[model samples]
Target: MLKKSVTFVKGIGEEKAKDLHNLGIYSIQDLLEYFPFRYEDYRPKDITEIKHEERVTIQGTIQSESVLRFYGKKKSKISTRVLVGNVLLTAVFFNQHYLKTKLVIGSKVTLTGKWDQHRLSITVNECKFGIGEQNSSYEPVYSVGGKITVKGLKKMINSAMEQYGNQIKEILPPYYLQKYKLIERKDALYKLHYPLNFEDAKKARRRMVYEEFLLFQLKMQAIRKFHRENSGGASINYDKENVTLFLERLPFSLTSAQQRVVDEILKDMATPYRMNRLLQGDVGSGKTVVAAICLYAAVTARFQGALMVPTEILAEQHYHSLKALLEPVGITSELLTGSIKGKKRKELLTRLESGELNIIIGTHALIQDEVQFHKLGLVITDEQHRFGVEQRRTLRNKGLNPDVLFMTATPIPRTLAISIFGDMDVSTIDEMPAGRKPIETYWAKHQMLERVLSFVEKELMKGRQAYVICPLIEESDKLDVQNAIDVHAQLQHYFRDYKVGLMHGRLHSSEKEEVMQQFSNNEVQILVSTTVVEVGVNVPNATIMVIYDAERFGLSQLHQLRGRVGRGDAQSYCVLLADPKSDVGKERMKIMTETNNGFELSQRDLELRGPGDFFGSKQSGLPEFKIADMIHDYRALEVARNDATHLVSSEEFWENSEYKYLVMYLEEQGVLNGEKMD
Candidate 1:
């Protein structure tokens, strides 16, 4: 009954159902779970207990006739005096002249507004003709969108609950409910929508939040269990001798941190269980080399490999570098991006399917249906967060239980790792390679643009390249284009003796690649681009980074842009050219100058901004919780995770009669993929 369409409810037809669907409510269960964002206190308050600036609902008798006065054009104020017990106060409603005739002298009225104690005035948010019912104290406010009004949504919810509220099954077993002191599912829903007091409302909210978190964590636990027990792992033999020989031939040695991470990856791959891991490190931490070595290991074990990147430029760079390192050892590799087409693409696919190609590196092209691998044993994705979960799964499905390694230079905090990549084993390369100099960072005011440009000129004269980054205006693409163009034009005019290139999201992929190629080859002495350069665009000779309006970006993003340079041995400098007004903005610049550790910056970013702004909430692979917050409600998350881990690890959870409803619920919630967990 809970799975039934919302149209089954009374007063809801096709039109109303469509409106509700706009708010992500399609089933009776969804409608019930549509929790209120806030509540209005309709309970009358004592006049003496009302503090200044407090939102209070008070009942009183009208003492003065409503006076309607016009202030500015199109603005009106309706004022009336009300006497509650022995205290008198003035109620003012802005632009509500229609209430003048209703609020007559000697009539009773109840007003809900913010109290101004000194002036004895109430700025009325709502006014009733008579005293409100004591039982109807709290009114829930839904975040209604489209054509659905809050009042209409409330009525629909009440109707749905009246019809199917009892049918809603409890997700947790009675034992856990008793342990947590949680109310029944039906009662929680009732109190959530229509509470009698603040305590009841709080308890209901806690119960609902816990349920959501538990269900999500259970899903993650089930996934991990399935991976551990399933016979889907790759049968790879780690060629330690070949891997060591390959690493020894490299121009540079691996850092201790990188070596440790490599050991972890090799160990996971050597096992029979499928390896699901994330390799996160700061910029210039040599993640690419680690991936190359692992790919070589898989290839030497007689299994094919594939590396997917977010961009064609990054893919091409990886192909070139990996080919240089692996080709000498007889590891055949090829690049397959969107641009590779027709005869070349056909030949590449043929070779990949025939097991002739040992490794294939590409962009989204690697996930297409036409691409096939002959015994694909290793799958590595660079800048893993850029791709969606489905995209990654699609690529993995093309291979046979391949050992998957996700690489990202954008360091994520451990807390976030558990929330976002909960099922995967995480390894961090916390140390940069030896002899790599830290990027010198400075924050400069907008007025110092000339000085910053002059410094870049000196770097360019020394045969070094520079990057001038432009801020992305979230409001408009036209504005973004104009900003980048204006900056490019300004830089072009300033440095007439050198070549300047421009790049933005508006540019075609081929065009962007061409501009990047020029910059990489030092043909373009100065590259003026947007956040497009924040990712993998390696130019070792480019030592200068100047970002305009730098405060608009988050700390992680600023760190990413700073990572664009400093790839070279020479001293690199990053100049933040911003005129920030807010204290947070100033603090961001100050923090950037203070430290270059991406992990530390990520934690600070989570605190200063929020989880959403950390890496963009949508792309972070975080669940959209109705009531639970990833940061503020972290304690609840931890408890739920622990409980879920315990439950999923026990065989009784899958087979016991007491947990039948929970198992069924896992299916209903799609946490178990509509199947039994076992």
Candidate 2:
């Protein structure tokens, strides 16, 4: 049953299967688990029994029908009225002209619409001919789109349940099920959609949510085990003399927080097991220096280290920064990207192969066929969320179980990070370097654009650089976000004396590199672009950031964009150009203006947008839950975490017969590879 395709399900043919696939139902299990988003209680009522503004289904014969059309400037409305029995029923449809023919005189029909007591009439929302039958029991209302309808989904799900309901094996042990007082798996599946009462429906949902949390915890633990038990790790040479020398040569002293994080990384690297660690920090928190320290350790231990980034601009930024930091101590660094080829590329690859280059930095090109390392001991990926799990794993596979360090500037809440990055040890550098001033932030209306532009002009004229950010690359009719193209043209005219540059993702790699270079070299005083600059480009002279349509972005995004300006010793200012009238929009503005703390803003973002499919992609290695909610299921999550932790800590728990289903589940999800377990 688990292996059966969706088309093989009863009542679902090729055409129906195509519709279901578009709705994300591709297998029998997917269909069976496609729980209803809501339930409908259908009860046929007489015309006199209906209440005002209440929906009801009534069966009667249409005595007369006529289409009444009303014209308007924006659009037109069409109304078709049917006199059935002793009630005057009106079917009002907006722009649905085809309904005129569907309602004919002397037609027996069942109409489901809203009853308006004040008007003494019924407004028809849905109509069907021939006095359609109404189900007396509860019905499931699915989320349908495209060529699929709710009725069709109900029919397919009902048919699927009839064939495979009894075939589902129990997931939880009898002891746990009894302790929790949960219902049977098959019964819960049926009751969730077609319950006798609302109480049973709640219980059914509880069952599903519990299972989701349980499996999620186990999957995370399985990944943790895979890294700890099987991955043959590197051993670091903890030479005190060399460490002291490297520290003394630095331009500035490390902060206490930075020094502590460095100590943690060194200790992890010194261990026999592989170090799977994540370094998180707010923008301008000196994370680069900590990473550079680790790279120095790897090179000193006679191993090659590679740093991969998502964009070419960031790769070049790291290349220059690391070189400036490491070259003074006799470590050679080289960069490999897609644009470099022929003799130059071959020479760099040969250096990497012969261990001549101790540190290598590049974008996706580093994972290509020609790039190889002699003794790749450590791998660091910047903006880890930007790359997929497969890409991260592919880079790790280049060496013999290399230690990995994933770094991110986006500050995720501590609890959420622990849960999400359950497979990796986490270290955070929460302190910014000295002499840096906090960026002054302001939330203003669109009417303040003139003043904002004047201030930006003054900043540019002071021999510093600035960035003008827009939400979209091109003009959009649907959204109100400012377009990068339109803004670029406007900025060029406004700042006629300064060099204005335009940038977006549509540009080529070399084109992007050139534009960024121009900006960094102070050739371009003002850059008008999208969020591409949010992650890359280091222009200390760029002290002012102007964001248009600021409400269109989340708090975390606003913080990251704001981080771009305050990198230098000069005071930076972020102008949020927006007129947010709505409550939600106003809240976003308030949060940004109140504080520049990324961790605090991240917590608020999580509260505003719940953790439902927030990190569902394989890039973050976070799974999507159907029936489970983080806020409502927080208690269940804690319970599952403790149980899963206990089970993973004990070796004998994996051999329990009651946990066979869990093992199968983990294996099916590709979280557990038996051959790699031992």
Candidate 3:
């Protein structure tokens, strides 16, 4: 059944099959397993009790009707106002001119839809025209839309279920299923797609979530086993004397947390196996210094070390910062970025290959075939989320299982980190460095825009620079938020005495470097940028940061933006200009104003928003679960992890005929990209 392509199903032509492929529904088996993301629970309600932003169903007489049409490239839309019961509501339907005849004046109908208070209207997705008792059942709400409607997907799924649902084979061990108290696989699929009640839907979801987590954890266990079998080169010599001197040479002492994490890293490196560790810390947490120690250890062992960053700006920043720190101790490093080209790049590569340079730092350019290391023993990547597992493996493959140390500024909850990045040992710098003054954060509404501008101008007048962040690089009709170019123009006119600079992802490398240089040199007093500046630049003189539409960002992001300031001894302020209407947005603002602890905020962010919203899914480099949520299905995750670990580790489990489904599930998932367990 798994081998049969979706084209075997009726109506799934070549074009339709391609669309299904884009949605990861490759075969008939995939179609049967494709479940609804949510259920639309429609319960009839009295018209008198309708609240703003509430989804409701009401049976009322349409006392009156008025239609307004719009002429455009698209078909004309009808905006009809209906007097239902005592409530007057505007119902707009797009390109459904035929509905005009069906929705006659003085007709009694049951309408169900979401009411947009601001729009003073509701878009009717469903309406029944008869006064009859109907069985209330949960309606499956899939994520399909546009070219492929939800109704269309439902038809295909129904067809598949009728034709192939009975042929679908289970790939989970019976004993494990009974142990977890999970529902039958076939039953769960049926209930998820067409559940009669909320309880049935939840039961189906529980079974599916546990299965998803179990499969994922099994893959991780296989990966861990693979790592253990593939031994790395001998441990890099940890010269105690050289390390002590390097620590003493630092301008500031490491915090106890930083030191503890550093010890964990060294311990991993001192082992015979390759060290795979993750260093997590907030911005300005001295994580770089800890990574430098690892790099130094690599150098002491007569092996090369490379630090790869996500951006050229960040690469340049780290290159200069590390050079300043390492140069005094007779250590030399070279930069090999995309910009460094021709003879300069060639010479740097030659030196790097010949062991002339002990430390090589740059962006993704370091992973290129030409940039070979003489004896690379350590590889550190900043913002590890930007790179995928295969990319990290490619870098690691450059050397003989080189020690890989991933670094991240965004704090991840401990449980989440274990679930997503459990491949490596996790060490966190929970404490910030000494003497780093906490940034003074303030929340301001749109009414205080003038006051915020005035405060920024005052700070600029004192020769201290300020940063104004916008959510977008350019204006969009779809988004009602401040953009960088528009904000830069406004600030330029508003603060004529001050020089305002602009930066965004769209800018070229040289252009970005020029703008950042100008800002760093105080030649530009006010810098308007997007989140691209969230990590790299260190502007101590910049004392004020004003973020427009602060609610548009996550708590972790707001904290990172706040980190741009407070780098100097001068008191700094982060003004959050926002008027969030949603409960979650209000909570984000309250959390930002309340606590500066990144770990705590990260856990809260995870709880408030799913992991996907906290950080980009691509950034996590983790599998996107169809059913398992890191927060909601945490217990399932833990149970799955425990069982998966035990199953993968036990030779008897893999060999047992009764447990062969365990291997089949792992194989079907293509976990570890089809690595051979045997």
Candidate 4:
């Protein structure tokens, strides 16, 4: 019944149904779950009690006739004085000329807006022409579009609730409801949409947040259970001596953090269960070398290993580094990127299939259908968030239940990690390598480009390379920001004596690789590029990164771009060449200069830009919670995760009659298909 189409609601026909569908509401259940993003508190407040800039609802009798006046072209304001208690407050409504006729003298009105104590005026957002009931004062705001207005959505929701609210069954067991002191699902829905008071709304939101989080957690746990129980995982023998020898062969020693993460990864690989682990390390934290040590372990255990990265350049970089590190230890490695095609690709594939190639490092080419492994054991993906979930799964499917390890330089906050990566074990390398200097970051206006460049010139004179990054590839009529092409040209002209190479997304893969190689070899002292180099490009000598229009990037991205420099022993610097006009933009610049901690910056970024933009897009697999905020309702998420983990671990809970509805719902959602569960 909950799955019935929303057209069943009164006054909602085929046309209105189409409008609701655009809101991702196809069924009655969706309509109920489509919680309001915010609420307008129309509960009248005492004029004396209201603080300045506080949004409040004030009920008063009209003391004067509204005087409507025309403002700047096509704009008008309706001003009137209303008597609230002993205070005579002025209310102004902008562009609402139609309200002039309604604001008659002596008529009571309830105005909701931001109050200015100094002027004793209210910049009214909405006005009701009466002393309205308290229940009607609390207005829920829904994100509606197309032909649907806020009033229309509210009406439709009210109609749906009137008809089908009773049909809303509780998914949680009675014990959980009592244990958590949660309100009934039906009651929660009603109060959420039409609350009598703010407390009612808060309680209702708490219930909904818990329900959404629990359902999501249960789904995640179910998928994890299905995988762990069904997919027969490989168990590699732990050869500690070989790992120690490999670590000794390295020119540098592993940081304590890296060593700790390595221990966790090795432990997972030694386990019988497939290693679904996420290795989160800040940029320049040496995740690649840790991955190399794991690959070496897999090879020594007589199993082949594969390392997949996001781009060809990173693949090549990893190939060189790993080859230099592992080849001496009898590990035959091969680089197989998309560019390695025709005969060369064929030979690599043949060698890979026959186990002649102990390790194959490549881009998405490693996941191609033709690529096979003789005895695949370990699969490590760098910058794992760059690839979609299906892409990672496809790569893992190539082997016979190969232990999978995902590495990301992006430092996701704990709340996000718990929600998004709850199914996987997470290990964080928080400590940087010893002897590395923190990158000196500065925020400079665009006018200071010459001074910034002069500093870059000094670094180049010392034989150290630098990267000049821009937000756009070319001049964009839509945006007024610096472009890589123009910047490249200007930098090339400015640094006439030195070589300046240009690289952007428009460049061919081979072209990008050639430019990167030149930069690596120091043939190009200054590389002007877009964000293509944001991922992985190891040049120890590159001591400077100058980012133009840095305000165009999120705090996390700016942190990532800054990470490109500061990879070497020498003191590196990052200059954000931006004159941000907005406070948020200026805050981003300020935050960048304030600290080098990626996790702290990411938390702030999440608060400012939100999860959608933080992940680059909505398609980034960050779950869209209707009511539960990963940041605000994090306690609910943690509780839900704990409950879900507990329930999933108990086989009896799956068969218990009390949880039958949950199992049925999960099965219906395809979270626990019959085949996988059985």
Candidate 5:
């Protein structure tokens, strides 16, 4: 049997264990549990159905053949003309003189390779003389590293299974297995790697995907349950009059959608239980204002509020904006960041400890040891996905069961939202503030650059700023396209009289902030940049956004870039420059031109690109599934989710032995016990 620890294995040493750690494999349990992403079936092909240029294997008799040598210093090519019955076929080998000795007159051989349709020939990669019909059969393709081949990997895995396969303990109870019709763990693992047929492989895959998602959801739900039971409820008093007075001082009225979301937040905070909510909004939908109102409520109840942002610039922006608004209401707000030093930092830390500061805004620096809150009741985080789970937990530790309100500008599809944020209650601001116009979007070929420039010049004449976005900050050796620097130069040459600002990732944070501030203050007429402006940089005056090589970006990213404009009352436009020859590119451009609804666009994006590519498997923090597709397998997901909910809700199973086994399995996966039930 494979031991619980990997060090007991034969080949793995301490140093090799570290290398496996990089791959998230630290124990023998981990290695045995690691599953393949996909399985390929290599069934034998019939010779009659094989067309020219098709990959196939054929057994045939080799007829008379001769080697023709060209008179030159260059390497000679060998040609063998083989006759199969009445049909004649030719095989050519380049710079391979050894092949001439392998094939003789009147010999039978089996060749496996792709055929060349133009020359009516087959290029052989694997060929053997006098091979039997027993060798012609199906094969399995496996993912392997540089040191391993498909056959070698299969051999090693099979050997390991022979010794430890049946030893795996089942974490799921027999009753639950029967209810879900899941196969045994050992059989599923073996069939998933090497199946008897395609149907068996698919069955194994279904069971594995269901098990992965079920375990993940159960762990999350258990953590939520623990948190709710241990963390005592907050006692914050509600005052609608205070909130009303604060809103009256605002420049504009809140939309109905925004008001509904604010109400949701207020209700959650007033309850005895600590609130764990997620506020999702579109680019221009006033989510920050809602967060500000929540902070106001907390401060009025004699409690402090903390707003944590992902970036330094965003934190500074929120600090200034909130200070300007709350100062008039006699509420003190301070900014704490790494940039503050000496006596000034010490003063802020002292104020935070004494509860003198009602609202504090900063980046991750707010979680420092010296920063203490006297009565922190509300914790709001912007762009919550940018911060890691442990980092957010650390910040929450600064308060006494503080309520958390996470805000995200990126609109997630409903299914994905449920999968990623299962522990938090979700609220969305679906409407934009009044006076924001829908951006006019269009797709054009590269030849229409002059027209696009002319439109930009017209927008500039109207006293509106414009943004030109390129895909890359610097030039890439592999792709032949214009970089941000090159594009900036080209735009400068075209509009020599117009003031243009350039921004890219290569610039320092301070430099980027300066350029963005210039654009926001109307100091620059045209801003040439990369996708660095996708988040947190708000320029309401910029009404035009032209993205170069728009085909290189995903639909969601393109939607965000388009959102940079149309933030003001002025009519805005987004021009997508792409090659018309690409059908997928054209379809993506069409989706952008159709609507400005982020939720709808997200659903369409999930359909166009599979969920893994849509969310980017590496960045999304979603569990990898071998068979369950988030888009195509929605039905299966729903069924499995319901099954997990039912299993966890049964009170009898809470302290049962089987439930304990499930909890142990989750702990083995690094999900520790926590308070809160999802």
Candidate 6:
């Protein structure tokens, strides 16, 4: 046992092994485990049967060839022209003089590449002369860097596997393999790189996907079990009469869906076990009203409540809204954020410590060491995606076994929710408020910009306001697209009589708050900004949102941005200005036009782009999956989830050697382990 270093394998020396390290491959096991994303099958097309637009492999003798060269002051171009019977195609290589010496005038060669119909050319990626018989029926295309050629990578991997394949040990047990109908590790690894056929490749892919999902599910289940056993139980009891009284005092009635969600939260809060729950609802779906009832209940029990918002603007909004609703019932509320300073911060801290503040709302400033609550009983986080795991844990640790409720306006699909929030309970609000009308959505090409602007102007004349949104802030010379600041300047030029304010993330917090406040008060007729207004800024007067470069945004983001309007009684409109060249963009816009359902839109989004990039890398905490695709591996995910549940519940498994290996694996990863498994 040489411990399996990649350098020990043939064809992979110190230099090549070091190059592989850049791709996250260090040991022989790592190299053997690196799988290809796809395989290219070459069915061997005859020169006479080869079409110009199709990607095909042709083997034929070169009847004639000539190399042409063009030299300029700073650059030169070289092209090779070959004639195969009546078919003639050009293979152009930029500034590569060595190609002239590689291709001879009359030599037999096999070409594998894309066929271009416009120029009647074959951009040859692989060309082997006199060795046409060595070509495989199918080629494995591994993901490679710029300097790493596909052929070179294949040769290196094949050589390495031949030398060290037998030394790689299987970590999975025999019983587990048979139970899942998985192939052997060695066979799967070999077949994945050089599959006998398409069916074999698919089989290899299935086993690997199952393995990754299995490990992920097991880790999540273990963490959930540990938390269930270790977290101190809450003793606070729920009062339905108090909740009913508060609901009765509300100006509007709650929907049946809202009532169902309220019941779920009440049941969880009343239990002795700590509540780790997620409240996901569509935009303007009355989630805040339900949360208000819970907060009131918590305060009525003489316990403190804490609300954490993702942004300062949202924190201020929640503070005012909660104060308005709770103050009428004689409950006090306080606001704390990074902006609150000097004596004001000290005063809030004093009130928080003395239990004078029943409910406190703030940003990350609430998690500071100086801030303390007298008896924090309930913790509610708005836009839970914006906060990390440690930030959430810090807030939870402030109180003694406080019930946690995580809220998000983005409605996640049930399948994705199960994967991401397996450790917490989920409650979704499927209904909107009674009187709110759905915003009319339309998509237009860039040529209709004037029409959209005229519509905004018409809305402004009616004593209402509008919002113009751009994906970027400042205009970049490199990108040929509109920016928010430039758009704001343009709007000021056009609508000189009306007040126009600009806001972006790069602006100072005070400036953003001022512009938002101005917009709320109708001082600014039109506000131009970025996605900073996506969360909690409520301006019921603004009835129109004209989004430029709409193709650059995802469906969920577009939906969230559109949600900024239609909050008032006035009919609102969302105009999507996109480029006509994008088919996917048009398809996404069509989804917006067909339905106003956030949950349905989210499901379609998950299907279109998958879950990894749904929130644009800022929020999605999906792990780096080597073989498993969260979108395509649904069946495997189900199997792995069932297997994890069964394994965790079995008493015999916890005492067995297999369980010891799993524990060691988790401990090495620095994860928590408790005797709940024992």
What are the per-residue Cα lDDT tens digits for candidate 3 across 107-166? Answer: 877777887777667777677786544454578888874477888898999888887778
TM-score attained by model 5? 0.79
Instruction: State which candidate, 5 or 6, has the greater lDDT.
Output: 6
Question: RMSDs, each prediction?
Answer: 4.5, 6.1, 5.9, 2.7, 5.1, 4.1
Q: Estimate the overall C-alpha local distance difference test score of candidate 2.
A: 0.82
If ranked by TM-score, best first, what sequence of candidates would result?
4, 6, 1, 5, 3, 2
Candidate 4 per-residue lDDT over residues 1-678, each given as its tens digit: 889998878888999999899999999889988888888877778877889899999999999988999978999998999999999989999999988888989998888888999999999988888787555767788998898899889888888888998898887888889998999998999999888778889999999899889888888888888878777898899588988888998999899999999999999899888889899999988898998999999988899999999988888889989999998888999998877778888988999999898999989888788988999999999888778777888888888889999899999998898788877888999988877799999999988888988999999889899999999998999999999989988988899999999999998888999999999999999999999998888898999999998989999999988999888779999999998889999999999999999999999999998888888785556888888889878888999999989998898788888998878868887977633321
On residues 1-678, what C-alpha lDDT tens digit does candidate 2 reach at each position?
756898777788898888888878899989988888876555557767777889776677666665657577545455555565677766565665666776677777777777777775566666667764654335667889998888778788888888887787788878778978989888888898678666778899999988888888887777887767777687877565787799889999998889998999999998878989989999988888888899998888898999999988788889989999999989999888887889999999999999898999999898887788999989999998888777888898898888889999999876667667766788988777887788899987988899999999888778989998999999888987789999999888888999999888899878888998899998999999888888956889999999999988878888999999988878999999988878877998998999988888887877776654234343444456777766657778777776777776777667988888887888888876643311
Model 3: residue 301 alpha-carbon error in angstroms = 2.4
lDDT of 1: 0.87
Best by TM-score: 4
- How do all the candidates rank in terms of lDDT, highest first? 4, 1, 3, 2, 6, 5
Best of the candidates, lDDT = 4
Q: Using Cα atoms with residue i matched to residue i, what is each candidate's TM-score against the true structure?
A: 0.83, 0.77, 0.77, 0.93, 0.79, 0.86
Please report, in order, the local distance difference test score of every candidate based on alpha carbons: 0.87, 0.82, 0.83, 0.88, 0.79, 0.81
Model 5: per-residue Cα lDDT over 5-56, one tens digit each: 6555555568656655665656666666556665432343455566877876
lDDT score for residue 136 of model 3: 49
Evaluated against the true structure, the overall lDDT of model 6 is: 0.81
Q: Candidate 1: how large is its RMSD?
A: 4.5
For TM-score, candidate 1 versus 4, the one ahead is: 4
Q: Is candidate 2 or candidate 4 better by TM-score?
A: 4
